[model samples]
Target chain A: MARRSEHTREQLRDLMLEAAEQLIVDKGLAGLSARAIARQIGYTPGTIYLVFANLDELILHVNARTLDRLRVPMQAAVAATDDPEQQLLGAARAYADFARSHPNLWRACFEHRLPEDVAGPDFIDARIAQLVELIMAPLARVSGAEGAALDAAAQSLWSGVHGVCILTLTGKLHMVGGQATEHLTDDLVTHYLAGLVMRAAPADAR
Target chain B: MARRSEHTREQLRDLMLEAAEQLIVDKGLAGLSARAIARQIGYTPGTIYLVFANLDELILHVNARTLDRLRVPMQAAVAATDDPEQQLLGAARAYADFARSHPNLWRACFEHRLPEDVAGPDFIDARIAQLVELIMAPLARVSGAEGAALDAAAQSLWSGVHGVCILTLTGKLHMVGGQATEHLTDDLVTHYLAGLVMRAAPADAR
Candidate 1:
């Protein structure tokens, strides 16, 4: 009997999350509320508290799901190419594509502000590290920089790519004219990788 | 008599914007409303509409002020150094510094989404163009890639640096450990510039 009840509880949680995700997709983070989630799932508002500590926790869970979705394409992009440069480009393209396709979901991942004193859960940090690891493989190959240098390179490069994604999505990049997001992504990766290679080149090579 | 009335109107406009800015600083974009602005300024909500077209217009004006404030440091950073590379670096550092110091205002510049059917005002686009121009001069000196190539380089590099600023400000960078935003900006500019120089290098130089 206990096992059956546990399974039901798990099912209820998933249902609420799905409803919350749908709400966010339609209305954005500002539109998400515990009462709204409960209404969508046909449960009482108090039921939401029973499942999650607070709305912030539910948002974090939603963001985690978004990150998980993002990870799949990124991993595939890396696997699709053996060339380090191509891998970097593919990953960047995948990231941009994901953001373009799911603007609200993608934005929610970054735009949701945590309370000032609260640190994000450890699992979310772990997920971010996992995403960074995807880039580090190619970055390590391109820069030949190891340990701390390799980590810094990965962070910097990803941040650059992410910036392009944000601006492009928000229409800020429209001022650049005629440059598609893909072209911009390609340009960023090509030039940035070329730069890393140059720095790693022997001094006498210049 | 008309001039005196016009002066009063201008003063009222400035007062409302100041109130809006303060509200955003304390509570973010969601906290900003025509009602809040009027409350802060000791005026009826109707007075805000009298000065601006609507809430969106008022927000745009506030963002314009933020951009104007941002321009000061960016211009100063460029003038502080003659080296093209240092100028780029300085500008990037200044950008990150500005975002850090005026996070709410800085974020409002990007966070406010215009309605899909509406185009951003020409003046806002001009302001963005001006910011890009600051990068172009130093980039033109560094890459020697003229015309479209120069434009592409400038946009890509700035986007990359902007990404670093976004992640750093939002606390995502903390997951990567103790790397300072300044170091990340330096690393991005140095490596990306090196890449551009290499791409521009003659085949025989290789």
Candidate 2:
């Protein structure tokens, strides 16, 4: 009987997250509320509190789910490519593709801010680290930059790709001639990686 | 008497924009509305519509003012430095600074979406072009990448900087030991510029 009850609770949590994600997809972040989630799930608001601490907690859980969805394509992209440059490029393209396909969920990952007094959960940090590690491998291979340098390079490069994605997603890039997101992503990764490789090259080769 | 009324009409327009900007600063974009702007400026909602076509137009004008504010610092940054690399770096720093200082207004520049049916005004396009042109001279000096290449480079680099600013501004970067925005900005500009210069360098020197 206890096992069945535990199983039900887990199922309820999943249902709430799904309902919340769907709400965001349909009406954006503003549309999400405990009352709304309960209505979507056909449950009382008290049932939500029993499963999750609050709306902020629910948001984090949803963002974690988004990160998980993001990880699959990114890992697949990395696995599909053997060359370091292609691996990095593929991962970036995958990231942008994920953002485009799941605009609201992907955005919520970045857009949602926890309150000042509240600290982000450790699991979310682990998720972000996992995403960063995906790029670190190819970056380390290309630049031979290790320790802090490698970290900075990975963050900087990823930020650039992310910037391209944000601008492209938001239509900000349209004003500049509507360059395709893939082209911009490729341009950023290609040029940035080329620069890294050349910087690491020997002076005689230069 | 006609000229005096025209002057008052222009003054009212300026007053309305100022009020709207202040409201956004105080309460964010969500708090902004035609009625709110009218209230802020001691006028009726109908008065705001009379001066600007609608709330969206007022937002656009406010964004234009933000862009104009951004341009001043960027151009000043360019003028402050003589070295091509320094000029580019300075301009990037300036851009980031502008975003940081006017978080609401800077965010509004990207966050405000015009209705799909309405075409963005030509003046907004011109404002964006002006910002892009700030980087062209230094980029040309560094890479000799002209015309299409230069334009691509400028857009790519700025996008990278913009990404860093967004991440830092939004607290997303804090998850990674809280790296300073300036550090990320410098790292991106340095590495990207270095790569551009190296690519342009003669093979023997490379």
Interface RMSD values for all candidates:
1.0, 1.6
Off by over 4 Å in 1: A1-7, A175-179, B1-7, B175-179
| Stretches of candidate 2 exceeding 4 Å from the true structure | A1-8, A44-47, A175-179, A201-205, B1-8, B175-179, B201-205
**TM-score of B chain for each model?**
0.93, 0.92
lDDT of each: 0.85, 0.82
Q: After superposition, how far is residue B144 of candidate 1 from its true place, in Å?
A: 0.8
Docking class of 1: medium
Position B175, candidate 2: lDDT = 30
- For model 1 the local lDDT of residue A46 reads 86
Candidate 1 chain A minimal-lDDT segment of 10 residues: A1-10
User: What is residue B11's positional error in candidate 1, in angstroms?
Assistant: 1.9
Q: Can you write out model 2's per-residue Cα lDDT over B93-201, one digit (the tens) per residue?
A: 9998888888888988887777656777887878988988889999999888887677778888888999888887876664333346788888888888887777777
Candidate 1 lDDT over residue span B114-154, tens digit each: 87789889878889889989999999898887887887788
Question: lDDT winner among the candidates?
Answer: 1
Clashing residue pairs in candidate 1 (N, C-alpha, C atoms within 3 angstroms): A195-B195
Looking only at chain A, give the TM-score of model 1 against the true structure. Answer: 0.93
